[model samples]
Target: MSYSPTIYKFADGGGAPVAPEMALVRAVLEPHDVGDPQLTVGEDGSLRFWIRASDDSEAEISADETGILVERPQTGGVFAIVAELVTKLGAVIIDPASGRAVCRAEEQTRLPADMREEAIVIDMTGDALEAALLGPRIAVGPSPRAAR
Candidate 1:
């Protein structure tokens, strides 16, 4: 995980914020606001939060006047948090690395074809393993395990 955070903000119309300062703060903090936290305020006045991603994993989630940050993520799983902010503030994500739009469906589909095939082999998200395992690009067939 990089020390840098994955930011969420409006891509254009930069004069005013997407929402009121307080509402932006509330929207980002409210969901993760449970329990006491040793919050810190940066020189820029941004607030940082520490969150538990799982029993064995922990993460930092933060909010500021400009936008929110999901910092040092291991996987893109945490990107789901941006969905609410997108709806609430009408904000779009800027990929920290690419500096381009992040929330669009096309971004998700840009994975290489070989990786998509590996996903089928590993049963990552889609249910095409039954077909993928049968042969190259075959249509889905009954799972061999289903016969058991």
Candidate 2:
């Protein structure tokens, strides 16, 4: 019941964003099975979506500049969003605390092992990105749920 937005930056290049942005939401359901849908933004700036049962864990999914590519992973359970054009240069982590979600940039520019408890939230853009790119500080904002 929480939404965290995190912005990732490309290390080598510093221009137009060529990386895909992903947002995952989870909800409780019956034993029959039900899971939250995944949200993805392609490099070309297109929206892609998918729905899967909570029981089906492995679902192969790719969200790149072209769009969304749906496939079932051989491993089974847990869908993997492929980064074709965007290399996922870096990632941010956002956590819900009190009434706000704290957004923090990765210390090493990679997705950490613990993503559930520590996720990333993207709350700033344009000038905000400029400032963050300079100092690399955490962004705090009202929870997307609370904003409404």
Candidate 3:
């Protein structure tokens, strides 16, 4: 089953732009060293890194002037690692599910309706991630058994 990966944004206090440095990100992930880390910096000054778990699951994190973006296949505990890095960066975790930002208490705001349907929506404020994780599976179509 294919599931939309959850998105987590990181920001500093006072809503300042914070770019997660590659060095720091590497250091933070050293302990969980799965293998050689793949890091790249885009022309737009965005930093991206990919780390593969021993189980072959991979997690990718990208950070730009706006904030850090985390994407993982499914709830394979990769977020826990991302969460730790967020805490280390001293940045706030904006969980879209709660309607309010986490890591630093803030007012609740709902993402625009259009963004809510997009595969990779940027505006974070809800528990869509958690809900997807806990919610029932969505059947893509008729099962093979049914077809038979």
The best candidate in terms of lDDT? 3
Error of 3 at 115 (Å): 20
Q: Over 4 Å off in model 3, which ranges?
A: 1-13, 29-39, 104-148
State candidate 2's TM-score: 0.24
Instruction: State the lDDT of candidate 3 residue by residue for 1-148, as single tens digits.
Output: 2332323333322334345565666666666555444446577766666755454556666666566665543444555565566556545444444333343222112322322333232222223333333353455898889999
Cα lDDT computed for each candidate against the true fold: 0.43, 0.32, 0.48
Scored by lDDT, model 3 comes in at 0.48
Residue 121 CA error for candidate 2 (Å)? 16
Off by over 4 Å in 2: 5-7, 12-45, 51-54, 57-148
Ranking by TM-score: 3, 1, 2
Worst 10 residues of 1 by lDDT: 124-133
Alpha carbon deviation, residue 92, candidate 1 (Å): 1.2
Which residue pairs collide in model 1, if any?
none
Q: Rank order by lDDT, top first?
A: 3, 1, 2
Compute the lDDT of residue 46 as modeled in candidate 2: 48
Winner on TM-score between 1 and 2 is 1
Q: Which structure among the candidates has the greatest TM-score?
A: 3
